[model samples]
Target: MRDWFVASRVSAGFIVVLVGYTSSAVIVFQAAAAAGASEQQISSWLWALGVGMGLSSIGLSWYSKKPILTAWSTPGAALLVTSLQGLSINEAIGAFLFSSLLITLSGLSGFIDKLIRWIPQSLASAMLAGVLLQFSLQLFSALESQLILVVAMIACYLIGRHIAPRYVMLLTLLVGCGVAYQLGLLDLSSVSFQLAKPEWVSPDFSWQALIGVGLPLFVVTMASQNMPGIAALHGNGYRPAISPIIAWTGVTGLVLAPFGGFAFNLSAITASICMGKEADSDPSKRYLASIWAGIFYIAIGLLGATVVSLFAAFPQELVTAVAGLALLSTIANSLAGALADAEGREAAICTFLLTASSVSFFGIGSAFWGLSLGMLVHYFTQAVSKKKQLMKT
Candidate 1:
């Protein structure tokens, strides 16, 4: 029993990584409202996304024997928050279906897979590093508002890294909670236990929603999040079938979209956590960790508010600090890979800077634009270099 519990706990680490990547509750609420969903409808949305992600993770990870994760699109969530300002709930669902269908088609048609092949590895790595750098900076910035909480978390993370590197995030969370309790920063009295129930909103498709919200959400999620996620998998020495995974996520999202599942895609940062040696010494055994994560996610989905409230009770700074520290290794590796190749240096640097800048143009985030520009520069430079060499010859 003791050994079994230990195994279970290790499995739970996958869910921890997922939660650490982006607390679902915080983002889901904002995402639902942005899509003009009501309170009840938003709860349903959580149910949809949670179940979708959980099931996809389980099935894909099991079949491929790799750590395949499915997550609600962070980029899509962000897009909805900005674009769903005045849209009706039905229209938003319409947008959801539209984008999902397009995603499915893209996966089936092999266009996205082809596109992924064309990108330089350095540029992809640079884009990933840039996207994550913002979160790392924010971890520190959060300290200004909650110094004691952040400091406690940082101290715990350092100590934990030395003692039990595999469970560093878990240890930091535990120690941070203890400090928060001692400092009287924690409020447990408000915590409540409640299951989340799915509430279905009738589908209403609108051209406006399709063009304005659906298309952009699809584009950004694929470009900014999924692309780098796949790149991370390849970078880390796991190459699974891309089209099937993409197709599966789209199908899951489509089935659950009416219930509040927005966009589901591959996870880069959290997946890496489970994929690493810390999870297990053997790469073949890592899938079990992801399977365990899926189980925990399913439980959270069923428990709903109870689980969300528990995480919400933690001081924000604690979450930020721990997340930042946990990702330090990954960030360093990504940066190293991005700058390693001499030929790709200029283009990779452009990608990194542009993504790090966080600029937005025409409602699109910098991640996509940065990668686009980088690829362009890389291709152009290669062409010119080849031309010059031929002339000299």
Candidate 2:
């Protein structure tokens, strides 16, 4: 037990939790607000999401003996922020339930993995790169506004990368906070110490929300989030049964939707932290890192309101810069994978460009369109090549 609970593993796990909260918790808050949730309901949203993630991460990691981490779908939250217009909280709950049900059905039918397999690796990586490209741009945008804070964080990240790559996010966070403090950017007055309490609301189903929010939510979570998460697990030499894991997340989301859990899915970016060599030299011990991460998630859920306030205290620029810097390595790795295949280069570039464009058609996001179009291009090119070869013969 002591061997598994070593300091480095604990720290790595803690860093994953920290980055998860800091990077996208605000988007969750905004989504709740857009749904017209009361402050109490927002707190409940945090509590539900935190608890759901905690249980899923710990339970799955223990059962599989792998670093199986779960996260609230950040892209889903962003979608909710935009798509919840004219929708009540109850209607949103209905959408969440609908999306979860679809996900569960897909897994049970064994269709989800088959669909994912149909997607070329380059396209999947391209979609991930496109989804994350906005954050990369925001890093520089924040620099333009808060030069010192961003510059300090970048310097710390570079130094940490050179000396101790495992803790680059932690080091950047510490240095960013220090710089924010010195520059009078830290504001703790809004911070408080209060535990979050869950509030339940009965769901009111609407066909509009079901078609608009539910369908898109499921698509983005599956195409943009879960696909990359599986890739991360595979890329890192870990393979667990994908269907059951996804089905379990869907079930958990279904149970918690009424309490403000919007979407639940496997984590790609943060899971990489716990699954990587920095977590442990021995692959077998990495599950312990996920276990520690689960423990921290429970604490965050219990203190959801307080954690929200604490994150709120940090300046926007600080948070933006930190999130961007934390994801820099992930973005680079994804870009490399997206462009890795010589044969798929044209299709992959098409996916990346369309996704990064952030264009929406018929209420669906670009990530979905990018993959769809890329696949079409792939097949079309292949057909043309084959026909030309046959003509030569």
Candidate 1 has a TM-score of: 0.90
Residue-level lDDT tens digits of model 2 in 1-393: 677667657776776777789788989999999999998999999899999999999999999999999999988998999999889999999999999999888878888767767777777777767766787689899988899889988888788777876556667777888999999988999888988899998998999999999999998898767876886676566778799999999999999999998899998778877776556668898898898888888889989979767877888888777667756765677778888888889998998899889897755567778888889988898999999999999
CA lDDT, every prediction?
A: 0.76, 0.84
Please identify model 1 stretches exceeding 4 Å from their true place.
Answer: 1-24, 34-36
**Candidate 2 overall lDDT versus native:** 0.84
Off by over 4 Å in 2: 1-27, 30-36, 78-92, 204-216, 231-239, 269-289
Query: Lowest-lDDT window of 10 residues in candidate 2?
Result: 322-331
| Shift of residue 18 alpha carbon in model 2, Å | 4.3
Q: Report the C-alpha lDDT of model 1 over 1-393, residue by residue, as the tens digit.
A: 343244423644543544543454676688777766766676677678767878888899889988887777876787788888888888888888888888888888887778878988888888878877876797889889888888878887678667776676666667777888988877777789877799877778878888999999888878767887786676666778798789888888788888877788888767766666556657777777777777777777777667677777776676667666656666777889989999999999999999889898876678889889999999999999999999999
In terms of TM-score, the best-performing candidate is 1
User: Relative to the unseen true structure, what is the C-alpha lDDT of residue 197 in candidate 2, on a scale of 0 to 100?
Assistant: 93
